[model samples]
Target chain A: MGVAPRPPAGDEGLSALRRLLLQPEQRRIEELGERLDDPRLRARDVGRVLPEALRLSATESETGESLSEALAPTVETIIHDAVRRDGRRFADALYPVIGPAIRKAMAETLRQMLQSLNEVLEHSFSRQGLMWRLEAWRSGRPFAEVVLLHSLEFRVEQVFLIHRESGILLRHLSAPDVAFEDADLVSAMLTAIQDFMHDSFSSAGRQPLDGIQMGDLTLWVEQGPEAVIAGAIRGTPPEALRGVFRRALEAIHQTQAAALREFHGDPAAFETAEVQHILEGCLQARYRERPRRTSPLLIVLLLALLIGSGYWGFLVLREQQAFEAYRERLDRAPGIVVTQAVADGDGYRIEGLRDPLAVEPRSLLGDAPLPVERLRFRFEPYQALVPAFVLTRARRLLQPPPTVDLTLDGGVLRLRGSAPAAWVEEARRLALALPGVTALDDGALQDPARAELQSLRADLGRQVIHFGVDTPRGEIDTPSLTRLADDLRRLQALAQSLGLTPQVTLVGHSDASGTPARNRALSGQRAQWLRRQLLELGVDPALLAVRAAGSDEPASDAQTPQGRAKNRRVTLDVRLDGAGGETP
Target chain B: MRKKVCLLGAFAVGKTSLVERFVKSLFNARYQTSLGVKIDKKSLVIDDQPLELILWDLAGEDEFVSLRLPYLRGAAGLLLVVDGTRPETLDTALMLHEKALDEVGEVPFVLLINKADLAESWHIDPRDIDRLVARGWSVLETSAKTGHGVEEAFVTLGKEMLGAE
Candidate 1:
């Protein structure tokens, strides 16, 4: 296309050619000028940089203010248009933020409410709380309501803001959970009562029936020029509650002055925010907590009582144990029987039979916890057949010396050790006579003179008379025989002194040279000869015995003459005994 | 609309008995003994407008106790009861009317010749009641025992009180 225009590119042609050639460029330049001059074009140019400019401006507060102000309505319009087009989208976009915001606000409110209810929670688990719970059940009310009722010194249940002239309820407020009938009627009755009071009691002036009481309920009326604040209260309301009602009525009269004056059958005028608030304030309750106090004197008294009882119980237990131990001791004591052991009031009574010779019952109480004075003993005297009692009776009757030990075994009384011969004889006589004593065994019992008697018998046994060869049965040495006779006499004296009958045994021996029959005859003759000599020495003939022994049991060797002489000797044996506490 | 209506008459004139069956009572008769008045509520519709009437049944006025005039302070209407067997009760009604007029101003009122169940023994002449009726006083005969004219009397008075307002 430029080549075709180049053919016409001479002075005119060239001018024409120049015009044609410059046409596109000239049009582009003019268009560029127009675009630069046009506000719409400039606007498009600014639109391209607007976002970046705004972003930069935002970093500086001063520039951002103008930019933000410039775009404020547009931004709002765009958002508004967007919401109008799809509100659900906008709502969905905001739900996440709004939900947590609302939740936080609600949680804060709940926290504040819980703080206010802290006092209520404190009383919820208290003793008084349980009582209020019961009352709540009985009265068919809420637990919180019952708690308020009891905790409050006085509760204004319902408040009636009545137009004094019309006796119409202008506004009413009641505590939560208060079930009331028509407040209008109550207000009217209150006015009527006031009127009745004025009519009956007053001659000229007005007399308001400020208070009306019916059982636990009290209707307190506080009168103003145009309104009467009548409060139906439970429990005994303090006098200050009257002041509250008065101030409330005065406040209502002030705020609802024209309304109260022009009040007709309709009560809409008094339902104002101020009037309702004032009436609600009148419907108040005083939550005065009951004081809790613990008396110290009561605690002290209780402690003292506890300790006193404990000590008394301990003493009683100890006494009982002591009594039991004493009873056991008596049960184990021989010759002592406990038939009855009972506690009689503060003392003990013991009744049983006891042997007279046995230990005293009181003496058996060793380190007893119970005082002796607190015990009464009633014992009947009876002979105890127990061996110990029998032995005791034997000792008591026989009067044996300390050397004598009296013991009972299997119902037999045995006396051992040494004692006077006269005492031993008496014990033997009486031991068998005692009850429960079958027999007296004095076999082991020894007399005090028994040693001297045994020594005398030994001396008599040592005496021997020598004989010449083949001299049998007739030879005697006078000096030795005399000594033997003296010993026999001493033995007899000791045996008699010891309350014993003495017996003398004479033994004879012969030499081995003699024949057996001859030796036996010869030895017997020698023993008879010795026994005769003993009888002459004052031993009784009935107490003498002779025994013949052959050389088969020799004292010495038979081959030597000296040994043979020892073998042919005469010997004596002695024994003395009598059955009593001790046989001698 | 709530209206306070008062019943005023002499002693034993059936002032309280006339309204006993016609109204809902929140207070017992003990208030009448102590406070000299008992309040009862009568909710009714007149001209399609719900009207609550707080009926203050003031104790009967006699030698012992007079009409408690302050009870009529805000009364929009009155039910002046009269025992028809006793002509003297009509005079007591008239006297109570005078006292009520002075206390509560001129308000809508109805004259009830009560004990009409014993009409044969009625001593109150109809000429006298008719004369009062001609004087612009609303009058009706009512027997509380028979429940006759009892409902109409309160309705008429409730209508008059609403109409007056």
Candidate 2:
């Protein structure tokens, strides 16, 4: 609103000249001012410039400091301001996402704890573990350490260090026995698998694979910022081995930091002997062998020895019993004098004296027959005049006739033969009264007198004489009479030798033509004539007797003349007193 | 010193006969196929070094079964035998060689073309032998019957194994 002051002529001239020179610059400033004054245009300008600044900041966060460290304080302040404004909403929004995740983490931790506990229990109760415990006690070592050493026997067969970005094998260490010809291939494969897992399953924030197990070998992988370490373990390693891997990775990062961070494809930078020495410290190959137990073969041998000895004892007892029974049998035999009866090997040897007349000792075993091979006899002859010997002597002294026989058995004497009556009576009385004789069996013995009588009757029957006619006085032929007398005398002499009284009887018979009274009287007269003839032959009167027979006692047919002459003959009958006696 | 060697081949390739010819110098006219594995030991001195070779004769590979890998655990060398009369046995022998390399890493080995006694009826082609030779594989023509190149095959494998160690 106020009026302007006028310039000097010289200043006015300078101002005109300056105004003409700054005219284009003033117009450009005016245009820029107008565009900056529009809100949409200003927003477009900011949009164009903000991305470069954000990218620069992101690059600084990634390459310089970690993202967590760069954003931690800012995020903390923002979270505090948000919580103050809407704590309930913040909690509600966070619960659905974080609750399950926290629970899953807790569950995984508890599951790992329980798994470790179960493994400890299984190892403590196992047979191999028990032996290990015993060995721990014997060696004065801690039980837990022994269990760790025995149950988790581990051998670090091979170890590899590979660059994470290029999948190049940085360093390799292997046991002398383990061969790793394709270690680079294995590293590449491992890196490829890790990339595949990261692509397939890695979420916003998750770790890559850490381990892989195949049969008895386990590959333990530890990843760092630029390098990865993989170890091939032969057996089950303790969980504490992870610490060793971490320590190795940390050492590699400290010593080979520049090589790991700015690594190309060259593995020579990491192949230093110092790195190998540091990695070798992680290797642990500890093994605890179980103690040997008692063998079962020794126990079986002891039992077999016991059984064998018992069987031998039983055989000895049986042999002793057999010998005892043999001794008892020898004591009961009377005729044998046993001098020696002993067991010799499998049999018995017996030496004694025996009597020839007595029963043999071998015969005494009738009730109990022993095996012939098990018995041996050696005896000498002896004269033991026992009861049997006395009986035999008595039989010989009797001396009976040739028809007599004697038998002595079981103390009984028997006579079984034919003899004279006197001889039989003598044998019976002598055998019954003999010493050592229990009984006499003479019932079978017979006298020969009865047999002699039968012979005498046959001789007298052939010498019968008959009258020639029916006359009371028959003709006595001298030669015929002499023969008849000789036969009668022989019969009488047989009876006398038999110690018997002989008696002769004469009988007369008549024909039917004569009268009964006259025939009877004539037969009586013929009997008296025959009796006198026998008396004249020097026979005893007591042995001569006569009998008369009438026509009722016919000798032949009575109607003929020869019959009448035969009927008138005199018949002689002889009898011996003792010889004709009943057999005694 | 002692070394363990494994014998691998197809069925009826006469792996046992090769061992008998080398160890006992005896041959049986009758063929008795082996079951599972049989172990035999032979002692020899090569270059003034005493060596005890433990030979593990594994069962031949059939259509229904294959060789067990556990039998090749600590082997230092391998003897791959193929019947000269059967060309298919060479395929089995090569396959087994691959498997053995996978399990035991790189080890010295020798390939034997067995039954050279019947050369007229041989089915193995000369080109196959030439191909193996070109690939730096040692191939020997041996016969358990006529006792040809039997000792050289074992001795060569022994020397290579000793040198490798």
Candidate 3:
């Protein structure tokens, strides 16, 4: 590279050069550069110190008055631009923290609203609640407050005054009945929670923690500049009480600010009578009249309802048992088949198939009688081959004499009592032929003809024929002969009608004065003569038979004249084919 | 006196397990992530003073999500837990500690390296622990599984909260 010659340096030459180089504007520019070189002046450079300046301004603005007002437009513009650019990122960043918070807040608010609505509905519909509403209307108080008064039972179990800075317990007041330990610990915890809340969420103009809920208890807090007043309340308290707590805290702060601000660990200074009175005012225990302990009338009505229902159930059970027993009995009855048994109201509808010849169903209930009117029977006639039904049919078909009795043993039919021969024969045939009859027992049955024959024999025994002379050759008396002929004819007819051939015999008898042989000969002649007389009287010859007895059988005695006269006659004898003769 | 203490850590660092071991002396092998803040109370006596410690076991911080500030509002002390088997958990604990400091100011705290019973699988460097100790940070090796140092960590933080040490 080529080098140029250097100009001469002199004060006059330097002045001219300075004048030529430094115009008024150039001097101003140099002065400005020097000023810019100054640390204090360079501190104002937009690129070098603008960020720090802005940061300091931001911090100052935060501590200064109305930080939000000052930064609102800028912050809003930045937020709007960010949201426009990437709203999803912003939402995602906020979701985890804010989503649950919003959800919980909405849920809690809805739940509380629903609970209040339910309470209102429950109270408004209740009888005593109606009175409470009316009282609220009359007193011109809010319905919600009236409801709180009527239904809410609240107690300020304990009240604590805690130092804000040190978390020291300044004062504690509790209801006499409430027992708790570590009041100082509770106060410290409360203060710690408040402090935590302030530090964790250190945003501008953030409110202190207002309350903490644990099951049925709530810790209501009112934070003052120097102290925090907390009330542990059980059950829901009226909203107006929050104002009372606030007012109490304000009063304490106003009256004891110096003491509270200077308070160290000791709480003795706060235990003064005034502080005690102030804390005592926060302690409250009040119960709404325990909602009229279950009305006596309601209890009585419930008891009555229960008793009535029980009795009704018992009656139904008894009726069912009785009906079951009755149904069983009817089912067991012969020739009766129960189809259905239904209870209708107080009555039973019984449906069954029954043989008319069977025993009555009503009669079966003799031992355990049922109300006849309450039982309705729907029976269909059916032909049953049971023994009892068979017997009934047999009796109806045969219609034996009244003296005859019929009995059935298992499948066997037994006949007893006297009856006509024809009736007995017919009954035996019918009973044996009956559907269910396995056998017929006619052993006890009697033929009426036999009885008639016995009576005829007795009449014959009382009758006697008399001869005028004692000799067998003597003629019979006309009147006596006529009576003998009539008697013989009647005996022949009676025996023949009884399906038996009868033989009429005339026996010859004499007193003890005659020889046995002569008596026997005379008896033979008399029997032959009587046979001929009977033959002449239209009596069948085959029906007549002679028996000669030489006084071997005497009707009475042969010694007395009257007895001899009764014995010295030719006796009449009547014998059936299967019956032996009886001499008279 | 009652003190509200918060347990802060990354996920699966045994913060809840530590609280369980300290409060109930019980430990379970199963891991269950807490979704939100869980509050538990333990009564203890330290230095002849009865104190009720209300433990706030907060859900572990997820990379995509931050903790709710309200949950740590009333805390008087903090327990920063790290899983010894995971060295990255120490960084997470340090980050949470920074957040706690910013939100709650200076409060009593203890740094717990959890799962000491599993020292064979320890990943936390002793140098990192020494650095914390050199920085005057309270550090303890704890095991929620074997209940080692869990009570001590809580008691130490409790004592500090009560200004006893």
Candidate 4:
């Protein structure tokens, strides 16, 4: 009780914190390995090795060891050569510029890798499993989000305080901070010492004196030798400190940079926003490296792939159409003709036959004499079901009917009563030749009396009108005001020839050179000019009306010379007086 | 600082046409309706100082009326157009001028009487033109179809835009 308790040995606690800090390198390597494992990573060469190399070199440098000690001799040589080329004494020396480069390279590599990985993963995780896994991961509680909250504030006092503790600062800080902060010259040495201690403890992987020991803190706490170093880095001279801090970042972040490659997949599709977002998000989360989904570039690349696939699908559809056409041709011989038998030499003239000699006989015509001369003919199986007859003349045989009618209501053939059995058979054959002719109808076999009466009525009303009148001046006529009026009247008569009576109205048109108002006046005068001529022609004045359409309605286009000439014409319309009346 | 001038007027009164004429010195016969405001720039020497003029050719449609005032931000002058043959354009021109004043405070504006090449059929009176001039507004008759008085109109406005009286 009497012995005074010595303050708990402070050096031992500091040493233990140092060990804890060093352990992060190993943890970082493991984290990096997970990121590289994604199958899709394309920069396999770069992504897999760079991050691990950076971590190993940085760790070795912290302990004042060679890269060879942390990794195999082969990997050590690579890191050694890279640092040597960078003109740095050690791998840790290249941290600043190289850290960012490594990170970017890893990101690119990982993005490329994802494309191949997706195929394997898609199959591995059944569709449902993949969907559910994505949902679950998204739904999972977010990791303790560590955001690098940057707040720039002007504090003259903070600078003054460091200046007042000038000697203490320089002894512990670096030369850059001394120069940057404009501290007293003597303070440079003191600040330099503090800077050394800070970097040394961090480099040694020791938790800063002020660092939080708790696993999780409700509020983020940035306190420790690390924080002090950060402050020093901020306060240091922009010129000198820039290099030092940059180097420190490179050293600390090398492993992360190398691991970045695991995330890259499809380097070409890496320009999308999603890929950028993923890289930014992972970096912000301080993930040892990003996963494929976290990479925004990969997402963009995936979108591009989908779009490419859609375009390929369109091409596939076009190919299918071409194939369908090709398939259809292959199933049938080219240019084959089929026809009903009639009595004109071969009895049936070929209709629209590319080659009349390519016709083939059907199975139903078993043992029937195969015609040596392959006269093109349409043989329909349904036509065979209907009775067929050979219509012959003693002297000259007429051409075959274009089509043999086989009208069927359901699955049965209705024939005219007068139809001979041969005609019924021909109808069945014709019906069968055409697709969708499942059944046949030989209406000729319905009733001979009914057939005779129907035929008579059909022939009774069939008539065609042929015109034989000739106009006086068959020479070409320009569409002047006079000729336009005469044509209008002539067209009206043409409509009458087709059994339609028209309400003839004469309209006049003109060119655009004249003033609109004057043009309107001129149009009316032209229309009046036509009205007088029509009256002189002894045309019914009561039936004829005239109006100035102006330049609104052009028969031909007005932009071109020919179009304008055609446009300057009168159009005649025939209006049937009754609803059911016919107009030609 | 460049002065932002908005060319606001009725549908075919030639806002784009006028701007195109001033900027490119070429006229296009085929006219298509402008969808939104287009920005064009030109600089003029006034009193030995280079004054940059940013002309915002505002689309002239009834639907665009709501968006007109926003484009007028930081504006120094407004070019209001009226079809010379259509005396009806005078009312539309006056309405636009009044809105510029009400929304953007006091700003100098010039009235462009466009389509002057067409024969005067709507009975535009000399006194009506003078009335616009009397109300502190400058007026110029121009034809976007031709180059008549087009340059003079912009040159006069350029003086007012550069704050050189």
**True-vs-predicted CA distance for residue B59, candidate 1, Å:** 1.8
Q: Looking at model 2 chain A, which ten-residue stretch has the lowest summed lDDT?
A: A290-299
Best by TM-score: 1
TM-score-sorted candidate list, best first: 1, 3, 2, 4
| Residue pairs that clash (backbone atoms under 3 angstroms), model 3 | A185-B1, A185-B2, A193-B74, A196-B73, A197-B73, A199-B103
Kindly give the stretch of ten consecutive residues in candidate 4 chain A with the minimal lDDT sum: A463-472
Checking candidate 2 for backbone clashes, the offending pairs are A504-A543, A506-A547
DockQ for all candidate structures vs. native: 0.53, 0.01, 0.02, 0.01
Which lDDT value does model 4 have at A424? 50
lDDT digits (tens) for residues B12-95 of candidate 2 = 998887777566211122312323555555567789987656666677998966776756655678999999999999999999
Candidate 4 per-residue lDDT, tens place, B33-118, comes to 32245555555666676655556666674544433454554456778878777676687777777787886667667788887788
Assign candidate 4 its CAPRI class. incorrect
What are the per-residue Cα lDDT tens digits for candidate 3 across A202-318? 685588789989987898998888888899998987888898898789779866778877653346678688788878888876766553344444456558879999998887887
Worst 10 residues of 3 chain B by lDDT: B25-34
RMSD of each: 24.4, 37.4, 35.0, 43.6
Docking class of predicted structure 1: medium
TM-score of chain B of each: 0.96, 0.91, 0.89, 0.83
- Please give the lDDT score for candidate 3: 0.74
Off by over 4 Å in 3: A1-221, A230-240, A255-275, A285-584, B24-36, B70-76, B159-165
Pairwise TM-score winner, candidates 2 and 3:
3
Cand. 2 TM to true fold: 0.26
- The per-model lDDT (C-alpha) reads 0.80, 0.74, 0.74, 0.47
How many collisions between residues are there in candidate 3?
Answer: 6
